[model samples]
Each structure stands twice: as structure tokens, then as C-alpha cells.
Target: MAEHKTNAMRLLDKAGIRYRVWNYDPGDGNIHGTAVAAKIGKPPETVFKTLVAHQGASLFVYVIPVGSELDLKQAAKAAGAKKIEMLPVKDLLKHTGYIRGGCSPVGMKKLYPTYIDDSAMKLETILVSAGKIGLQVELEPASLAAQVSAKYAPLAKRGAGEAASN
Candidate 1:
């Protein structure tokens, strides 16, 4: 196994959350979906990816399943914010200490507003990045959210109902 260390791994340690690390080749330059599809052999829609967005001066983290996108307006409505926007790549990296594709909802540089898609509750467990590309962790969504003090909301920009109706 390829040994790796990342802030996400550290957070799990801090919380005493049980997790199993899965590593794969970092090549192919695939996004989170591709990695999940290849590694777990699951459809991309079943894999969730972490995202960073902003509500005024504060930055928030949103973790939603892959194949779905974060709807700024929907997220703002869910979070009781008048406005929300995708955080700048630079600012996101600085605040979370994680680069894109490697960002985890846990172990961020600073704790800001956090929201996890309610859809996650449907799954027994899900995979999230291990604070680095090519590495992922398997854990329960509810447990993961509790460890990070995250809240649940309708964070997806789309739904199976055809309308992101939230």
C-alpha cells in the first residue's frame, strides 16, 4: 500500500472515527467521479466530492455526490444566506489546506458553514478524498458529518425528479 499523510486523515484520527484508506494510481488525470468509478467500481453518481463556497465573508464546505453540482442559489437558500458563490480556487486551497480534487469536508484550515447533501443519508457509506489525490477514505456520512460539525441541506444543483426542486 502507498503510505500517505493528509489533513483529512489527521481529522479522522482526532475524532476517533473508524476509516479504511484506499489508494490507486494518481495517473489518468480523472476527476473524483472517474476515480470512484474505477476504484470502487460504482457509478460516478454514487461518489461524492467536496466543494468550497462562500456566503459573504465566510467560506463554507459542501459535500455532495458526484454527477451532481452545487447550485449556488439553492445552497444559499438552504443555508439561510442571501447569496452564495463558489469560492476562488486560491482562497479555497488556502482556507482548507487542500487542493481541488483532494479537498475533504473534514480537517479544513478553518471551520466555516458546512452542508452535506441529504442524499448522502441514503447510502450506507460513501467515499471521500483523503486530503490528497489518489487516496480516499470509506466512512459513514452521518458519522463523518458529526465529527466535523456539518449540517445537512439540499445542496445539489440537480435531482432525479428532473427539477433540483428543494
Candidate 2:
């Protein structure tokens, strides 16, 4: 197997964090979190998606289960902002140094405050993007949180009319 190094993977290596990388064929550009989870053979609940949000001038990062939605009201409170909205997709790469499906909470253009949904605490490990499409990194939830200085919060809820992805 060939070695592939992404910024996130390098950061983990430098920090001495233990993680396992999984790769899949992206196949025509469908990179939704749920699809990634399926391709990687992990339950969606144990696979996290990184989302960027903004309140006023500050940017925030939210990590939640692939199948769940970020509760904007709860996210706002957890972020200590009056309100929060998802950052526009057009600005994702400029702000985070990553495109939509490849954004990892670990390595970005800058270290913004990061929050992982509290439910992750119950799992032994969680999977997140490896800062590239077709790759994922799996590690202890606590380790990931520590790597990014993330706080745990109740930031996720099942989307309306959607089945839970347990």
C-alpha cells in the first residue's frame, strides 16, 4: 500500500495520536457523510461530519454524527453566540483549507473553536474525514477532541422525517 499524507494525518502523526485510516473510491462525486460511512463500513452514528458555522465575525466548527442535524439553537448556545448559521459552501475552502467532503476538524487554515456532539463520548471511537475525500481516520473520541481543543456538547438531533442512523 502507498502512503498518503494529508494535513490532518500529519498533525496526528506529529502529536503522536493513534489513528487508523480507511479509504474508499469516491465514485462520481457523491461525498455525503452518510455515504462515506457506508463505504467505510461504519455505522453513521459513529462517523462524524465536520461543519463550519459563523456567528457575527467568528467562525466555529461543529462535529456531529453523519445522520444527524446540527441543532442551530443548541449550537448557538454551545458556541456562546446569539445565533449561528452554516458557513456558505462557497467559502469553505478559503476558510478551512478543505472542500466540503474533505474538511477535518483536526487541520485547517486556522484553529477555530471546535465542538463535538456529546453523544460521541459514549462511543469508544469515532471516524472523521482525513482532510481529503476518499479517506477517513478513526480514533478515540477523546483523543480527537483533545487534538482539536474541542468541547463536547449536545449539538445534534435527528433530522425531521429522517430515520436515525444508529
Candidate 3:
């Protein structure tokens, strides 16, 4: 079968950005970021997940490595918001034009303030959802940052008892 083209991919193409697409079987259940990384033969550190948080009347986008969790305090600082909370899963599609597990920072319904974890700067390429659950796009971190106007900050933290995998 031919590879699927997502809105995110089309946007990247239109902008003259180069990327490689990877697809995996979603199987009989939901797939998390870590599993995605393994399926694509990439280290967990190189695969990032897009999360939307609501701060006051605004929504912000955060991209962090799948192996780490987003630090809400750090996210608030980066977003310059007094407080922020993850937007409800049910509202993701309405707010971001993508469903849960498939949200990509690019090609959202609107371009919210986007932030990428500073750790990504250390990697040559990173993988993000290609606007779908079974797909991902690999591209230079700097290129992705520039395309989305993302600010780099320390936005992730190792979960309790979770050894750093990246």
C-alpha cells in the first residue's frame, strides 16, 4: 500500500521541508510513544509527543520526548502563564484539529504558542506524529522548531523510579 499523506506532511512539503515517514501497526490496542519509538527503530529520546495545555484563555503546545513527562511547573514558566492544565482529551480534536494520540504540533486548527524540550537540540533528528496514530515524521530538530516557531526550554522530567532512557 502507498504511504498515507497527512496534513502535517503536506504542510511540511509545501514549506520545502524534507522528512521521512514511518508507519507501524497499531495492532489490537492503543500504542504509546515508547512503543512507537521501538517500532520505528528509534531511541525513545528521539520520539516526541505533542501535548496541549490550557492556560487561562489560551492553549499552548508542548513537544517533549516520549520517555519523559512534561513538568507542569516548567511548562507554565515556558508559556508565561500563571497556571496551565492539560486540555481534556475529548476536546483535543476540536482545539487542535487532531485526535488524541495523533496530534501533531504542525497543521493544528490554529497555531498556538509552541514549545519544544531543549533536549531535542542535542539530537540531529526527532520523530513526531504525522497527524495520525500509525504514522510519524522524522526531520531535523532545528527544521521542525523553525517551521513551528517553537521555543526550546527544559519542559520534561523523569518520572518517579523511571531511569533516564535517553
Candidate 4:
């Protein structure tokens, strides 16, 4: 079966960026980032998820490892906001033009300030949602960051009971 192109893919194509699409089975009903990473055969740390947050009138996008969670305080500091709150799931599509489990930092309805976890710098490439559930785009982290005009910052909070190794 031919793969369907998403807005994120089209945007990358137009910019002459190269990427590999990994399609996984979503029939299992598990669309969580870590599970998707396992299905795609990539380490959880290499598969990132896009999260959207807002502070009053401003919206921000964050890309962090699937195995980790976004630390709101760190995110606010990274984005220079007084405080950041996760954008309600109901309001996701209205603000980002993408739904949960498929939001890509790239090719959003608007290019909000984006921040990628600096941990991505340790990997040669990273995978992120391809604007659709069950699909991911793998590309160089720097390339992805440049495409989205994103800055690299410390934004991930390790899972509960996980120690900081760095």
C-alpha cells in the first residue's frame, strides 16, 4: 500500500528536506509515544512527541522524547513565559490545526515558538509525528529544528522514579 502524504511531509518536500516515513499498526489501539517507538523499532529516546501549551494569549510547541514528560516550569522558562499550561485537548485542533496523537511541530496552522529537548542532540536523527496517527517522520534533529525554527532546550522530565543520568 502506498503511504499517504501528510501536510508535514509536503512541507518537508517543498523545503528539500529528506526524511523516512515509518508506518506502524495502529489497530492495537495503543497510540502512545513509547508504544509507537517500540512498534517502529526505534529507541524511546529517539522518538519524540509534539506537545502544545499556552500562556494567556500565546501558544508554544514542544518536542520531547517519548519516554519523558514535559516539565511545565522548564517549558515556561524556555519559552520565556511566566507560566505554561497544557492546551486543553478539546482546543488542540482549533489552535494547532492538528489533533492529539498526530500533532507535528512542523507545518502547524501557525509557527508558534517551538522548543525541542536538547537530548535530541545526542541522537543522529529523531522521529516525530507525520501529522497523522500511526505514521512518523525520521530526519536529522538539526534539520527538523531548522525546519520548524525551533530552539533546543532542557524541557523533558524523566518518568516517575527515573533518575537523571546526566
Candidate 5:
């Protein structure tokens, strides 16, 4: 079957960046990061998720491993903001033009400052949402950062009771 192209994929193609698309079944109604990693047969640390946060009128994007939670304090420090809070799911599409579980740092309605967890830089390649649910795009970490003008920083923390992936 032919793979469907997403806005993120098209953007990568236009930049001549090479990427591999991974598709998994969304039928079970489980799209959690860990579930996605399992379906894609990759380590949880290698599968990243996009999250949006805001401070006043400023918006920031973060890409971190699915199994890890965003460390709000670290995120705020990285962005040089006094405080940062997750963007509400109800306003996600309006703010970033992406619905929950399908947001990609790339191809957003506008280019907001983007930051990726330094953990991603440790891997040669990382998988992130391909602008749609059930789809992911695997590419070089450096390439992903360059594509989105993102910086790598310590922005992820294992959630309470979660195993450390470090």
C-alpha cells in the first residue's frame, strides 16, 4: 500500500531530507507514546512526542521521548521564560493547527521556538509524529533539529513511578 503524505512529510521532502515513515494500527484506540513505541517496535526513548507550552503570548514547542514527561521547570529555563504551562488540548488545534496525538513540531501554523530533549541527540535517529495519528517519521536527530530550528536541551523527566530511560 502507498503511504499517505502529511504536511510534515511534504516539508521534509521539499528540503531534500531523507526520512522513513512508520505506520501502525490506531484501531485499538490507544495512541499513547509507549503504545506507539510498542507498535512501531522501537524503544520508548527513540520515539518522541511533540508538546506545546505557552508563557503569556509566547508559545514554545518541545519534542521529548514519549515515556518521559516534560520537566516544566527545565522547560521554562530552556526557553528563558519565567513560567511555562502546557497548552490546553482544547486550544491545541487553534494554536498549532494539530489535534492531540497528531501534532508534529514541523509544519505548524507558525514557527514557534522549538526545543528537543538532549536525549534525542544521543540517538542517531528518533521517531516523531508525522503530522498525523498512527504515523511517524524517523530521521536523523540533527536533521530534525535543523529542519525546525530547534535547540537540544534537558527538557524531559521520567514521570513519578516511571522507569528511567537514561
Candidate 6:
């Protein structure tokens, strides 16, 4: 497995990209989700989570705000793959070397197509998982995509009650 400072963190620092590291209470592991949004004092829509998926034989990732779920159909369409689905835990581990709770969009074992949900673009700064539980880093969506070589795309929509921007 990767070390404490994951390839993600190293990439950020190497690029001299500015980001703030936030630590929060990960209560029984589930807290990395909504609890992280609250801990950072940001709306759930401004705090994003990293999800790994597959497009044909290739791996893809979606970085979306916590308020929404991964729309697999949208993701597949964006990737131009006939089908797309969540990568199994074993595949996720093999691909990113990070457990499900601490996946980061910045660094991975290989370069996967990265989709940053539209919701994140609404915020001047967004929080993303920092390759470990209880750790997060804040940066602009554009910077994350550029520094990480991500392919910007919309992979999710705001949950039923929220507005359309997400």
C-alpha cells in the first residue's frame, strides 16, 4: 500500500498548488461523508467525495459533492463508453491503493478520467479527500483538474430536492 502521504498529497505539493488540510472526526468511518462537510463548515454541495468507476476496460473517477450520488449513466455518456459502473472494492484497492473511505482525485496508481461535479465549480474553494480518513485538502476545482490532469466533466446531479447547478 502507499504511505501516509499518498501520491495525491505529493502531487499537490510538488505542483506548489495551495491547499488547506482539514482534520475532522470520522465517527465509526461513516463520518468521512456528511460529517466532513459539517466539519469544514461548508455546505455538503461544496464538499466533494471521490468515487472510482469503470468505462469499458479503463478506470474512471468521479469527484462530486456529498449532496449527490454518482449517476452512472451520465458518467458512461461522458466517458463515451457503452457502460460504466462502480469498480468493486478489490479493484478500487488495486487501482488506487487507498481504501474506500480515503480516496483522492488528485493521485492514483494510474491516470483515470476525472469528472468534477458541476457543484464544485460553484464554490471558490472545494474540499476533497486527501488520501486518508480524517484528512482533507481544499483547492480550486480548476487547479485540481489541471494539476492532476483530470478531464473535467459533470458526473452527478443535485439530489431530488436541491437546485440544478449541482
Among residues 3 or more apart in sequence or in different chains, the pairs in candidate 2 whose N, CA or C atoms overlap within 3 Å are none
Global CA lDDT computed for model 5 = 0.91
Cα lDDT tens digits, model 1, 46-152, are: 57899888876877788887778888887887778889888988787778888887888878888877888887877788878888878888888888888878888
Candidate 6 lDDT over residue span 1-166, tens digit each: 1236656778998998888887776878867577788876878877889998886578888888786788888888877788888899877878887888889888788778777776666679888989888888888888998876667567776556865543
Q: How many backbone clashes does candidate 5 have?
A: 0
After TM-score superposition, the amount by which residue 107's alpha carbon in candidate 5 deviates from its true location, in angstroms, is 0.3
**Candidate 4, residues 1-166: lDDT per residue as tens digits?**
2267999999999999999999998875447999999898999999999999999989999999998889999999999999999999999999888989989998899999999998998899999999988889999999999999999988999666765444
Models 1 onward score TM values of 0.88, 0.93, 0.93, 0.93, 0.93, 0.88
Which prediction has more favorable lDDT, 3 or 5?
5
In model 2, which range of ten residues has the least summed lDDT? 157-166
Report how far residue 16 has shifted in candidate 4, in Å.
0.7
Error of 5 at 10 (Å): 0.3
Report lDDT (Cα) of residue 113, candidate 2.
Answer: 94
Q: Residue 121 of candidate 4: its Cα lDDT? A: 89
Output the worst ten-in-a-row residue range by lDDT, candidate 5: 157-166
lDDT of each: 0.78, 0.91, 0.90, 0.91, 0.91, 0.79
Instruction: State residue 20's C-alpha deviation in candidate 5, in Å.
Output: 0.2
Backbone clashes, candidate 1: 0
Better of 1 and 5 by TM-score: 5
Candidate 1 regions with alpha-carbon error over 4 angstroms? 28-32, 159-166
Q: Write the per-residue lDDT of candidate 5 for residues 35-87, one digit (tens) a residue.
A: 99999899998999999999988999999999888999999999999999999
Clashing pairs in 4: none
At residue 24, give the lDDT of candidate 1. 64
Model 5: colliding residue pairs: none
lDDT of 2 at 132: 87
- Local accuracy of candidate 2 as per-residue lDDT tens digits, 121-156: 999999999998899999999999999999998898
For candidate 3, which ten residues in a row score worst on lDDT? Answer: 157-166
